[model samples]
Target chain A: MAGQPPKVDVPILKDLTIDNITENVHRINSQGSDPRLKYILERLVTHLHDFARETRLSTDEWMAGIEFLTAVGKKCTDVRQEFILLSDTLGLSLLVDSIDHPKPPSSTEGTVLGPYHTHDAHDLDLGSAISGDPSGTPLLCLCTVKATSGAPIADAKVDIWETDSKGSYDVQYSDYSGEPDGRAVIKSDKEGVFWFKAIVPVPYSIPFDGPVGKMLKVLGRHSWRPSHMHFMFEKGGFDRLITTLFLRGDPYETSDAVFGVKDSLVIELGTVSAEQAKKYGVEEGTKLLTHDFVLVTDEETRKLRDEEALKAMRKLGREGMTIINGQLVPDVD
Target chain B: MAGQPPKVDVPILKDLTIDNITENVHRINSQGSDPRLKYILERLVTHLHDFARETRLSTDEWMAGIEFLTAVGKKCTDVRQEFILLSDTLGLSLLVDSIDHPKPPSSTEGTVLGPYHTHDAHDLDLGSAISGDPSGTPLLCLCTVKATSGAPIADAKVDIWETDSKGSYDVQYSDYSGEPDGRAVIKSDKEGVFWFKAIVPVPYSIPFDGPVGKMLKVLGRHSWRPSHMHFMFEKGGFDRLITTLFLRGDPYETSDAVFGVKDSLVIELGTVSAEQAKKYGVEEGTKLLTHDFVLVTDEETRKLRDEEALKAMRKLGREGMTIINGQLVPDVD
Candidate 1:
């Protein structure tokens, strides 16, 4: 090579086209910031720009998206999280959740972190009831938390929340009714057991009075989330598990709108006699569900799980036959 | 067929994956909303979902986008339009402008309708000055509006706004200093001729104090807009033309941050003698520009131009080689 081609500073060109946008995103040499944040944001910009290109999005369409986002933001309050609901309905939440807390075999799988989980889950004693109200079907939950190595994970915090039998979260009910009623937290005893009596979970549609609801209706899809109880088990030195347990035979179980249902998380409820219910100081003819959760023992396992899930999820997205403008086209990864 | 397969409602299957998101997008139907808006929104959803899949965006990444958008919305007020600025920097404003008002070959091609156009231009006589401030370089404008057939278009409203030589628009300065001072509306006389004395256009960066600014900095791109005067010519029958004429040889002319510069919109400025400036009631040594705009007389031409430009612009986006994770990938369109 007698003559070397001059080095053209390509990334700093600032062309402002979709092409330049692609270059600029990668060229972001952040001097100081969380490297993790930078990595996430850079990838996000690449995908967003690529999306704009693939659709050949017009300005009106872009503006419309902005307006919809603004409306969603405005709709958010202390009780309502339109963003999470948006992510849930779009299925991005599932993609993220699946990657975030990947479950090893025999481990409890996670679901959509629905907008109803409050950190202040009231501490309940073992075998105590979660709800005070005697509404809907009576139910009892008995949970055991343990390490994948089959050892008890004593003193772990088991956070539990679920909709009432009618399928409404406490926050939503508390807006007009009093404080939300059917949620609580209990610590696992030395035997890694925690139990609570509460109403059974039933299928419920997501709140559809806002933009997300409008999107669901327009897309000709149901806003129903399969009936399930939310759960999170946390202990120092062990990977945290964010999950949901679905009733085995709920009608919407297989067709959950947010794709939160998983096989391992489902449990069958058996009828408990009035005498058994009275022993727990609850209503007669209660239903009881027993569940055991296995957590990954090491942090490396959890990280590896997340990495593997991301790869698998990416492959799933890449394999789907994509449709655009009413035409079926193979997705290009 | 001996056996008919069970009819499955295809679109309602809410499998929260990229493929399902793609399917759901094409399934949208409008029983009653504006059909055009419905179509646009459906395409938007498809492209957006594909983008997420292509990137395999994590939850933290998605939430970061939400937070950025929420902050952008919160930063917006009556005096500041952060959304418009965001659109401008992303080159979306120009794409929209080109489609909304297509320029016939002889007609003036429009540029980004920068956020400063206040339609309330004071109807000044032919030779009034837009800025009374004596701080910057002086300039006089002479404009002639004509139809594509070379016919003078009388009674056309010529609304104009520009930043001073100091590169600050009146709206931005108004808050700290006082009333916005550098914008005015002057009607063309019967001969389709109008002139106004004001400061020559100077390159200016967009107001970079909000989330958009933070975004620009992080993206490693300048927020500077090329110097140009915003113009709008409207009549009863002609397509309204929104344009900006950059000072011919400005260094940033080719690299406009908003992609607002057009070959036809750049015009060179000639210096006028002190006596000539006095005739126009301005300072002694004033800059002068004589530019004529040709307008498309019919609606059909405008629509056709927009349709054609959209095709070309979209093709430009689709042509770029997309690289993700160091892999040169072909965009799934």
Candidate 2:
């Protein structure tokens, strides 16, 4: 009742078969003005139909999938992204990150930006404490920002956030007041040094009260991610880095439920002596985490990304695919 | 925080690459107690990862897909199922129906069960009128239920429903009254005959106020379905039949938006005489539609379904797959 028949010429689709349905769908969707959308949808439909056919998927199984996806969508809210969780758990997030954000060997590797990041983190001076709660072992984080050429990146903005000893972000609380905790924004000094004091993060489960949690149970997989601190760096003329540092000894480090851990991103924490802690205005026996983050310049990043795309296009060309007006299309010669 | 690490021996998932990620996922999920679930997930993950790699899917495109699925999920409600509509438009519903309900050559072919059926309907005597509205031209439908052997099946429960003159189902109205209109359930007599009077259904658009509607627009496809009447039949020893009869001359008969039109289901209506109309207690100038619905006995249907499953398993076996304890698994040497 809300739409009229097509005013343009459209094909009459009848008696669709599994073997011919994919082609018909592609034909119908070819009418879209956006060539990129048409390309993506064509590939999606092809893969979906192929999957169903190869598996000989039953109606009950299809219904189960539909219900599962519906529950996942219904579980999403302002602070929670269940779909992203699903992608992460399925290893898709890492695949996309690897393809889109390929970096030079000297540059730091990036990982999934979990759903807990917020824009309201408090901006504090270097070496200031970020935690409001007076629990957990105090940690002194000493970090340096540098270019791939080993030059100091002065005045770089570093955003950091992590869970408390109880393994929960501040926003996860039911009675969360509109205040930031265990998170902050700090700037690197002229020497490219930036330090902060906060509680050491604890191994935590990705929110397990939703549909994703139920899926993990069905997969016989755990939901625990290694205890890790998140860092996002932004600077002029450089690529923004979104990454995490996993504590080397965390039980879940190697088998992170979200599949976010990389060997280079894992680090061992050292002990901060009383004398060294005095310089950081912290108590004795505090945990120490020291690391240097290497960043690629924006120009270099763009070049690398373009090269990767060209490489992919070449690979696809070998398989009889070609790019037409910025859209990947079959080479139908 | 709510879940501990897996108590069982779980594989350490680390450094996942696009090529290796699918196998790792399958390995992790292989610990599930249900072999069928594991088999389905393995195939799903394989197809999903293959799609990404073949297309070189970018981060932006992946995020767009996630957002689209979330929107589709959010649009579902108690009375509306947007996911089903999405499945219908993508031809998955039809594909599943075609595979699951393969009929003998003598039996009527079945089509998609559009997401508009309801369990609640008024049961009436033979030749009773179904429409509460008095506006549209009256139609008299004559139907018979017969077995594949041409034996009349007595007392078959025939359920019928359709749209009114305005091309809208009663439930589609915001202020829908509780009364039923243009829909009813009638039973066949000893001769397997049932007749009912109702308004002639008109071509109508699927609900286009939701995410699926937007998707159709993006694909440059119209949402109009041909004018059709739904019929479902049930008997003690026969398989339930869910199907529709499309008006042969309707503009969308060849290209139903939902890909639901089957060649065998297209039908033509005849003109009823004044005297013929009086037999049904309707005014003169009534339209007439007569058809016989052939049903396969439950035992015969079971045999056909088993044969289909065996054929699929054999096909997969030729592709290095096997059914193990009712679960499809890779036949590794």
Candidate 3:
């Protein structure tokens, strides 16, 4: 089309106001084979244009933003996803997660995936100590996994990770190099029960060495996340439930920086006397906590998750070729 | 703050909804060290959050966007500014330019300062053909510069650039090494007149070897810009005028891909007979055209332009540092 005669749009330079930018995006036949991408990109363009006009963003401001994003990309490595932290602090990640994973009243609620979970969570037997470091006050924890209908979800896989008493996950410490710590994978026994003795969770700040930290400083916001334990549950024929558990009454719970904590995800931390701790074969005056998880992964859940996956595919341009003027076409330079 | 006890936010996870994100951005002590920057960032965060919610943007979709931006950054260099191209194609650069350079009724209009514009536009004298390479149809051109109030703008600096007959800028051709071809800078005579013999511009495509090209393909939009000549005029103590002039009646005059053609910037190209061409000391049956530019830089125009610049500064966080809970504070990690 470079050398072809161009379709002239007669100049009418009168009164082309800023609002036209928002409208022009929709008029460009940007819609492609996937109606969903059309919807998403259209929304994005509208929002972005509105943002520019409302603030009257200048060229310098825009260039500064571009530079900030470039730095964020450069900071990303195998162990760090600064973009995810960016989305988390902005509350976008949790918002999308919530939209994609709504559950029945009894099911465990999902929350923010606060940048610490890894793929290597390995299984251990029930009643085992999740952390062998023995560096903090112990917690005897027990949990159950069940289906929405109250049936025991046998062999459901659960991954758990939490901060140490010092409020730092092992990976966040100097020696770990982002290695998994205070984390373990365990399967529910025949009775659908999982138990472990580990340290009590504490509030912690997110990584502050990158662009997200700079943004937070500019916004006058803190980077603290409320004390909580991460949990992910999955079993065949059931929708995977990724969530976190917070100790009720934790002070920072209201402002979990990334806003990951939910009321339904809260459970009590019970204190046990030295004698009772001895009976459980644990440290004296230990804390005891127990909770059950309910999952929903039947037909309706499957369809919903499938829709989320499809939206992702459309975004990646994996689902269809870009259509031009309602006609199938390959990319033309 | 990593090991310090977090500021207690008294736990109450209820009322944290998608709508809260929009409201929360505004609630920030958006008053920064630069009040304007605070306002713009607040608006940006609000619009962006709302867009995410409206789209229910999934993690994969967000990541795909990040990857797209990263590629755009990596594609940019000293020779290539994909970011500017992004702004131009999206119609933003023109929109902002229009707002900042609005003129009175008699003043020449301004348009996009396309990515091809370089700092290297050098000086040439009147009657000199811009392209000594002698590859295009000759054009004997004449132009004048004036003040909005009818006074001649003596000694005004005029910089002009255009595509050759084949509709390609020198920079787009590898052999040129971005040297000037159909482009020149010249000083207006005492009568505010400028003259030259050069090739007539034809419609052209922007560089298509980058991510922007891929975006154009996916959006089903052409990459062509209408045939035009770029003009930048500046005189001592007057506002600079940066714009493009498109030939009237050209086919792409109406459907300019970049939406740069303005009726006020459009003029005629007249044909000259072989004898007349000979009399003008040029090739037989050549073409002739003339245009006059009027600049606006009086008190009224200065005030308006100043206001526009201020608005942009405000958008760049010009008013204050970010205030937190109504108090000025440094960034906290």
Listing candidates in order, what is each one's chain A TM-score? Answer: 0.83, 0.92, 0.81
- Per-model TM-score versus the true fold: 0.78, 0.93, 0.75
Worst 10 residues of 1 chain B by lDDT: B1-10
A1-333 in candidate 2: lDDT tens per residue? 356755458886747775677787778778877766776788788878877776767677888888999999898877778999999888888877776667798989988888888899988999898887777878899899999999999999999999988888988998889698889999999989999888888999998999899989877788998999999999999988888999997888778888888889999999898788778887778899999999889888767766665677676554666555434555655
- By DockQ, rank the candidates, best first: 2, 3, 1
Off by over 4 Å in 2: A309-333, B309-333
Residue-by-residue lDDT tens digits, candidate 1, A118-201? 876678778777766667677877678888778988999888888776677778864545454677778999999878877878
lDDT of 3 by residue, A1-333 (tens): 532332443233242455465566555535345565666667777776666655555455666876786677666655567777877777777776776675666777787776777786667777777765666778888678888888998898888988787777776666674445688888898888888877888877788878888877776666777678888888988867789888877767666667676777778898777876766787666788788889887565646555554454466465443334322222344
Provide a comma-separated list of chain B TM-scores, one per candidate: 0.84, 0.92, 0.81
Ranking of models by lDDT: 2, 3, 1
Error of 3 at B288 (Å): 5.1
Best by TM-score: 2
B172-233, model 2: which lDDT tens digit per residue?
A: 78787767777889999988889888878898889898989999987888898999999989
Pairs of colliding residues, candidate 2: A205-B1
